[model samples]
Target: MSLTRRSLVEYAAAHFGWRRAYGDTTEIDSLLNEQALTAYTEAADHAALATAKNTDALAVQPGVLDVRGRVLADVLYLEGVLTGARNRGLDPQLIERLDAAVDHGHELTVLLADTVRTTAAVHAAS
Candidate 1:
């Protein structure tokens, strides 16, 4: 299945302590927007670099990368938060969930990156 912004948000909310309340919405929205913007910018930068190299590299889809980027960002943010929580002696169950989330996020990121790399390689070969 294709990665989606909503899914990424849901995953973070489920694993991390992200809330969908009034105050938290702003932060969540900002993170999503930032990742989306970064994804597009990176895609453009990649395209420019490919052009400079004179190789017909396939264009990376910003939407796909945006979700992956958000997932990675969320995982990193959660890891720090988890560390703080651990230091504060928070609930063991919550810590376990956060740890699982981080591991899952890393797996997803690697899989996505590999898929993108394989696709680009195929396109370049063609």
Candidate 2:
């Protein structure tokens, strides 16, 4: 499924204990949307470059790229949230929650990178 602001908000709520009442999510949502758009743009560029480098290469599945982009966008969102909370001097509990969320985001990023690399290798060989 495509990434949505609601999904990201739900993720923040569930994982970081973020509450809409605590802070207006407008800024966060805007940043996330921007990052998501950038991810798609970069993904398209990467796909184009990959295809150009290897005329025989099978087209990379757009879904795979989309998932990769979403994972990256999540990581960036978590990082931004953590930074913003730190800058605002939010409660320690919320900061800790966001810290953990960032750690989880890092883990997700690593896994996604590995998966993409492996998938790309497989695609290149086929």
Candidate 3:
């Protein structure tokens, strides 16, 4: 069976009990491995804020650097997992399921980012 993007996203959302409709054209971007979604979400607010505040001449900051590094590691790990899964001749459906889970996690990150930004705006207004 061939793996399509649709099948993967559905599996991810279902695993998380997330009911929101995910569009096919929606792009998933993140700096994490498949296993790091939970970790990133748990730390997103503090990590994101620190990243935003650490602008200086010196490139290496603290929180932001750590977050970015972890994100890159996650992406690499995910890529390896995907490649390995495909190489194993795993059922297309099963592979799609894992892919969907990862995609869902990435989408959640985006949603979280949106929420954080909106909350910050509200705080600023008040």
Sequence-dependent TM-score of model 1: 0.52
Those runs of model 2 whose alpha carbons end farther than 4 Å from true positions after fitting are: 1-61
Candidate order by lDDT, decreasing, is 1, 2, 3
Error of 2 at 25 (Å): 17
Whole-model Cα lDDT per candidate?
A: 0.76, 0.75, 0.59
Overall local distance difference test of candidate 2: 0.75
> Where does the lowest 10-residue lDDT sum fall in candidate 1?
54-63
Best by lDDT: 1
Listed in order, each prediction's TM-score against the native is 0.52, 0.49, 0.38
Candidate 2 lDDT tens digits, 93-117: 9999999988887887787677667
- Weakest ten-residue segment in model 2 by summed lDDT: 54-63
Q: Rank order by TM-score, top first?
A: 1, 2, 3
Tell me how many residue pairs clash in candidate 3: 5
Per-residue lDDT, model 2, residue 121, is: 83
- What ranges in model 3 sit over 4 Å off? 1-79
